[model samples]
Target: MANKGPSFGLSRQIQDKINSKYDPELELILVEWITRQCSSDVGKPEPGKMEFQAWLKDGCVLSELINSLFPGEKPLKKTQSSSMAFKQMEKISQFLSAAEKYGVTKTDMFQTVDLWEAKDLAAVQRTLSALGSLAVTKDEGTYNGDPTWFFKKAQENKRDFTEDQMKAGKNVIGLQMGSNRGASQGGMSYGRQRQIL
Candidate 1:
């Protein structure tokens, strides 16, 4: 396929309504804020920061600017339950505490695991090996060196893997040597050979 436009279609009337609600300059700033939120390049930011960010893109306070820009328009009413807000706030507090203790931010949680800027392939390999070793050791199994498994587990735990002592789990006769003969004859056996070599 060649390309399509935005996922959401905006009717001309709706676009006009939105445009009339804010000044062009202010709208541009909000666009910038939204753009940053959608951008993968943006680093870790505090929760709820995006809301204020959209407000601050033009270096203007939200309440003042919104009122000035849309004097006649009513702000969108959000009827959130108090309990939900409390729970969310509590969770945020806990996360902040944990992040402070660990010297990591909530943004770092995604940034660190999903993407890393290592110096070279050697460094990346070293990191991946460290993760693989940790996975097998933590579970008391032989290291299978499955990047997919390691990546999934690490993402789930929200922690990178690193270990000095790790072992591969011992294979049982049932699956390792019995019905799954193809697996035994295929890359599994070849991998075993490589390990020995």
Candidate 2:
């Protein structure tokens, strides 16, 4: 007997949920990404429920894609100190909140925490990466359909002002009055009085 061709479509419920959560353009991008990442067969059709579920379970592809998008940035690392553990928990909480907004269940997120509890750093990293991927989907409509908006925003927020830069800014502000010391007619000089008519 000839082998039957692999099934090619997602279930209606899952498809509907995805559609509701993502815009059509974003959905297309996600479908293409999934097809590229999960399919081994040449000329394979779009991923079906089994393929989608398997991809979610494996998570390596999702993790790789996210890591590639954010080069030189690893947000999830093994916690060595108490402060690091606190920070990791805060990050996990944020991820859970974002994932919930994108329709991921708490139970699914708890599995990631379980990996952390087990001291499987690799697994936790992969899980956090997968969650990051899913969180991008929630940015579709609100962020002009750019999936990397959150990541970019997070990067911007992480940037800290250097002490030298802060001191330079203060110096600039302090020198403003000195710079205007000689200008009294057009530009007001410091401590100058305007006569009342």
- Among these predictions, the greatest TM-score belongs to 2
RMSD of each: 21.7, 16.1
Error of 2 at 73 (Å): 3.5
Model 2 TM-score (2 dp)? 0.26
Q: List the residue pairs that clash in candidate 1.
A: 141-169, 142-167, 142-168, 142-169, 143-168
lDDT of 1 at 193: 42
lDDT of 1 by residue, 1-197 (tens): 13434334566555445334323343333334323322433222333323333322221122222222222442322212233434433333332333233233333232221112111222222332333334434453322333233333333446544453222233334453547434544444543445354
Q: Which candidate is the best by lDDT?
A: 2
Q: Candidate 2 at 21: error in angstroms?
A: 7.6
Candidate 2: C-alpha lDDT = 0.42
Candidate 1 residue 101 Cα shift, in angstroms, is 2.0
* Cα lDDT of model 2 by residue, 1-197, tens digit: 13445434575555355334323343344545444433442123344433333333333343333333332453334323233544545545544454455454555455444333332333333344354455464343222223552242232336689999888877565544556555657664769788889
All candidates: TM-score: 0.16, 0.26
